[model samples]
Target: MELQRLRDVFRTALDLPADAPVDDLHYQDHEKWDSLAHMSLIAALEDEFDVMIDTEDVINMSSFGEATRILGKYGVDFNG
Candidate 1:
């Protein structure tokens, strides 16, 4: 469920396939994930998890895997 939800955020951010691989995700890697899209992503993720992420985490969220790792620190167990 978490994975799917995370994917939904990515899909919305990048306008990419819903099932895009984690490794394929990157800032500016897609047309939709530019500066504005990055802010949108932070909002989307905060909304999805109901948790506030620090500015450091937002800056570090450059890829799907990185996002999963950062959220883990916020008590979000994506593996569960």
Candidate 2:
């Protein structure tokens, strides 16, 4: 459920297809994910998860896998 929610956030922020593979997407992996879109994606994730991400982590949030790991630090239970 949380993963799906993150995918939704990606779709909204990155302008991807509703059925696009968001979990494996990385920053620059898709043409739509420029720096502007990266910040937009970050904002969407922050808003959706209600978690404040540090600037360093924002830089490190380059992939969905890494993102889930980072979000885990904020108490987002990916297992749920």
Residues 1-80, candidate 1: write the lDDT tens digits: 88778888878766677666645678877667888889988999999989899999999998888999999999888888
How close is every model to the real structure, measured as TM-score? 0.86, 0.96
Q: Give the residue spans of candidate 1 off by over 4 A.
A: 17-23
**lDDT tens digits, residue span 1-80, model 2:** 99889889989999988999887888898999999999999999999999999999999999989999999999998898
How well does candidate 2 score on lDDT at residue 72? 94
Q: After superposition on all CA atoms, what RMSD does each candidate show versus the true structure?
A: 1.6, 0.7
The global C-alpha lDDT for each of the candidates, from Candidate 1 onward, is 0.84, 0.92
RMSD of 1: 1.6
List the pairs of residues colliding in candidate 1: none
| Candidate 1 displacement at residue 52 in angstroms | 0.5
Model 1 lDDT-worst window of ten: 14-23
